[model samples]
Target: MEWTGARYADKPTVEVRTWVNATPERVWAIVSDVSLMPDMSDELQAVQWVDGDRPAVGGKFVGRSRHESFGEWSTTSHVIEYEPGRTFAWAVADLDRPSAIWRFRLSPKDSGTQLSEWMQMGPGRSGLSYAIDAMPEKEQKIVFVRMREFEQNMATTLAHIKKLAES
Candidate 1:
């Protein structure tokens, strides 16, 4: 993935895709399982269902993430889309004006599944806002760095998911 300086309210984003040698069901099982996320993510340290029994449109979850530069923080996410074996997505904080939107999409491809993970950094105030506010002159630099981190981490996550699902 290469940075193109895509922006939303001055925030950049990263999206990565990978083809996994497994069925959509297999990929969805891992992708939609919030309990399994922390293990697959580099920044996410933990996750838990905040409401409802499992992931569904309208469900909520809390994610705890720690970064070397940003330290640790937790955010609440509200499920905005949920389609078993196809897609799962959530908006972080202030559903009406979210700080971020994250999604996973799965599609059948050559007896396997094509999985893509994407994130859009805010149209509203988020954790990154603090950094931008602190260094207005370096806002673009900060977003670029964070998006790069997200891309690398997303690749790792897709690799781990592919490994597990294929096995």
Candidate 2:
């Protein structure tokens, strides 16, 4: 069935936040260190630096991501916004549409730094994501049974960051 856009609207796009038990500055030491992602993420297979310095605004990097449910996906991201210990955002592009923005904002609180991770998927990206979400209903459902796995993946990744920051 061809999508009429309702399925795209049903796709859940959300930000996952956690109160990290460390200062924003401390957390930035990890998140802003772009080279470390492959080691921390199970899905990001590799990051090949394209130009400019690591984690700087306007820098570009190409990477590959692999998931059991989605196989391999590739994209190059350009840093859109960067602030020392407060925020950083990037746009991943070159597939079929505008791009998706991944943003992280840090706010200091009494408990620790509040880490909010935001993902804004573009038009076609949302539709494509909904198609993935719809894959489990087919007769042979083995293809993308865990299609929305990024939700859990991001949660776990954020938890890992919390753990690393605390100790």
Instruction: Output the number of the TM-score-best candidate.
Output: 1
Superposed model 1: Cα runs more than 4 Å off = 1-11
Task: Give lDDT tens digits, candidate 1, residues 1-167.
Answer: 44455444854567899999999999899998888888988789999887555799889899899988889999999999999999999999889989999999999999999999999889878877898898876776678877888889989999989998999
State TM-scores per candidate: 0.93, 0.76
Model 2 off-target regions past 4 Å? 1-6, 9-12, 94-97, 124-147
- Give candidate 1's total backbone clashes: 0
User: For candidate 2, lDDT tens digit of each residue in 1-167?
Assistant: 73322233233255788899998999989887767678778988888768555777778888788866467888888888899899988878743353566788899998689998777555445325645566635412321233345556677778888888899
Q: Give the TM-score of candidate 2.
A: 0.76
Q: Can you list the residue pairs that collide in candidate 2? A: none
Tell me the TM-score of model 1.
Answer: 0.93
Q: Given candidate 2, what's the lDDT at residue 3?
A: 30
Model 1 lDDT-worst window of ten: 1-10
Q: Give the best candidate by lDDT.
A: 1
